[model samples]
Target: MPAQTGLRPLNMKHGWPALALLPLAALSSIFNWNPAIILVLNITSIIFLSQAITASSVELAAHLGELQGALLSATLGNTVELTAGIVALVHGQIPFAQSVMVGSILSDILLVFGCCLVTASYNKDVLGFNNALAKTLSSLMMITAVTMLLPTALYASFPIAEINKKVLLFSRGTSLVLLLLYGGYLYFYLGTHNYLFISDNAETDSDEDDEPSSPLANRAKLALSVTRLIAAVVATIFCTEIVIENTSDMADTLGVTEVFIAIFFLPIASNSTEGVHVIAASRTGDTDSAIRVIIDSLLQIGLFVIPFLVVIGWCVAEPMTLFFDSFQTVAMFLAILVVNHLLRDGQYAYIHGAMLLALYCSLVVVMYAR
Candidate 1:
């Protein structure tokens, strides 16, 4: 005989612990406010993040499903950092953001990867170097690193104390050209046979993550999906600005540079969701999800963050090129290159993970030294 507790599905499913976490994270955000709004936002963010993970896990039930959950986590976590950046920008705390961006970038490349490697070591083989793919990703990361030099170059080469029309034009032109070229390369590369060489995964492993149902293309109306995606992005930027503005005010009291604030705190803030998801993924042994979260953050940093900051820098009269001088850039470059090599073999072994974790640890030390 079965002992049945008559409870509603929602009530039973919406366990008290998960619900409790949201308020806790939101309240955490308030601690950062005058009376502290960080507490509220942090707690809400935590809550929302948990819901997102719950939703994603239910919707996407394979190992691959974990990817969406992890990405959701990263996105939420990064919001904190973004909030800080927006605050600094509005309040004219440029240096603080500079610091935060550096830290955030470093954290994405090293910390996430290291964590992934360490946990992955328990189950799979460490990845072997895929030189061709590694070199390609390394090249892009390097280019991005060099693009960071644009602001410095503009300052050093053109000699502008403030943002002149000509400088702005030049910068915008450079951004457009680089963006298009890189985009085209991505399209071609991903579409081409070269992708096969770059991406080496065991067929059996991939099957383990395959969806039971057909993909959502037919059921999920394309127009609606596009609109939802756009709305999500717009909303992210809006909320991010609010959070950034508040964080900047506190930075002065904390006595940290915007650069440091941007790098360390901003990431911790924005990546709130991702960090939690990573832990969740680790507990569940969802390696693919772990990998997806890492890649998603990198892409966001490389794609979204770079361009957004460039535009924001223009708005704020600061050089977007400040990213280059930070050792964080070098650290980012190293992580991507190393990862490409490691992932190329597709084995996903512990030693490879160890190597990655080791390098990440080393970079943290180097970042401290620099």
Candidate 2:
């Protein structure tokens, strides 16, 4: 049996602190506490639950083979964002949900990846990864950017009443196409060319760390891991609903636009664990794994989650379009361009990371002002 390469078992030291926040969050929500208090508590709790989901999902995915396990882990990793987006949509907060979709991709590529690069390059002048993998991911992101651009362009060039139906139809059709493209990307990633993505160090480590276990014990562990994953996901849904319910109130209290909150805060809270994981991987000198995590996350949001949300919106009669606001569309394009440019040579330095973080901060300031 191969050892679980990127998967980490749950750590009680970190888990208990976050788990302790859950009851407080529940009580705050139940007692009609201040919206800010409720928001903080619930968002913190959701972040913790998201971590729990990741840890348990990793354990469960370990039971499956490498490619299948990687796929499962990637899908499960976005559960928090997906759950939060759906909850927002169900409440008819279309703009809020859309902001989240955009923010997630930006945060992953610019913010999270930036932090990873900074960490990896702290003692070293240059950090490097697989150039082929970087280029492939970048090309896919460019395709996603184009998909996003077309709808926004269509909506912008026409009258609202005349273009609204057309935009929705185009979004739905384009979403289906993007979803298929995502499927093909997955097949390419996990089936045909998986060796390109997997790091030699990870394979060597797995082989060295492989240990024997009885079949019955493995089954028991798998069952336990699955149960924990399900429980964490359920808890996350509950906490996410609480957070969404209070989001508007919190925004009003803070005197910030709800779009600002959605773009800046929600993505950070939802993706905190994954961000930390990326940084950790980079710190351990596993630049390949860290880069993969960052790119995989960006691709998943762009190709899978956003399109999936559009289809879901159609079913719910919410008419979610791919037409992001002009600012958001530009931000997405610029973020992708910056990341792709930096990674073109498969090398990065702390200065590159700092530049990305600076860009992210500038976007935050602009969004906040808007």
Candidate 3:
């Protein structure tokens, strides 16, 4: 029950660029055009589609109540990451998929959250959010970081083929545990203790802005929003497939590792929509919702998307695991540490934002040099 803001009408202008590129990307994919060209077209198209998905999710969320709306937004917001990860795994791109999971979490918590802080703190010396919720989310993030660390440590401790047999089993077992934890979390927050998260000011403001409308009109709007959301998701799935198919070629052409592209480029496109939504919430002086959006998304990716992927891979014979490389595991741990430390007081400033951005940039450089 985070603060609910007035629903801004879905902005089609933000999606115009994507609409213009949709046909070209489809044609490029169908005609088997240059891999780099296809990759670029599809990547750009996915970014635009991501924006549309976010806009529609926001509109749809307005029709639903706070708890259901938050769930819907979090699910739809991670659509790109989930879709891309599944497609990559199906194609046997394990490292790429792994990087996507790590990258999406990192980008949301560090890059996107950083931007939100900078924007929210621009006119003010500091901004604050719900301290209790922030601490809870930070604690969950610490658990996720630990989950990531264990598998990597296991892999390092037993590098022999004999010990390799236990890694996937361990990862699968951990995935099931993580999935259960996420379910408990949803029940805890959205069911038993939702009142703790709801903001009275947001509820009052939203009620003030509410306008009476006919049941028929409300139905029509809901129908349109659902249709728009479904359409964007389908379009994103198509573009993501195209992009995944060409990722290797694009990496080869650019002379970079697929892990590098997955970490740096893929997350930007996949998470751009969420980033925009977070920033908008911050700008509207709803820092609570803004922080919720970022933390919720990160939790969704860590607790839901990653485990879901691993489970899906288990079913699909892809044998995906939570065992990320040493560098990625360490980076994720450090990121969660930094974010938790900065957010412990539930306050942020421009300098805090700059620190996160600087760390992100440094990580990028290190990855490139690796």
Q: State each model's CA lDDT, in order.
A: 0.49, 0.80, 0.80
lDDT of 2 by residue, 163-257 (tens): 98898889999999989998888788767987777777677766876899999999998898788778778877887788777877888998888
lDDT of 3 by residue, 1-370 (tens): 1222332333656465787899999999789788788878888888888877777777777788656776776677777788889998888888889898888888888899889888888868766768887888889889888998887678668858755678889988999999999878887777897765666655776678798989999999889878878888998898887777878788888777788888878788987766776787778777777777677778888988899999999999997988887889899899999998877877788888888888899988888888
Off by over 4 Å in 2: 1-16, 66-71, 156-159
lDDT of 2: 0.80
Q: Clashes in candidate 2: how many?
A: 0
Clash pairs detected, candidate 2? none
Which wins on lDDT, candidate 1 or candidate 2? 2
Model 1: how far residue 229 lies from native, Å: 7.7
Backbone clashes in model 1:
73
lDDT of 2 at 217: 95
Superposed model 1: Cα runs more than 4 Å off? 1-100, 122-127, 153-170, 193-242, 252-258, 272-296, 312-370
lDDT of 1 by residue, 309-339 (tens): 5567777776543434545545665666666
1 against 3, candidate with superior TM-score = 3
- lDDT, residue 119, candidate 2: 90
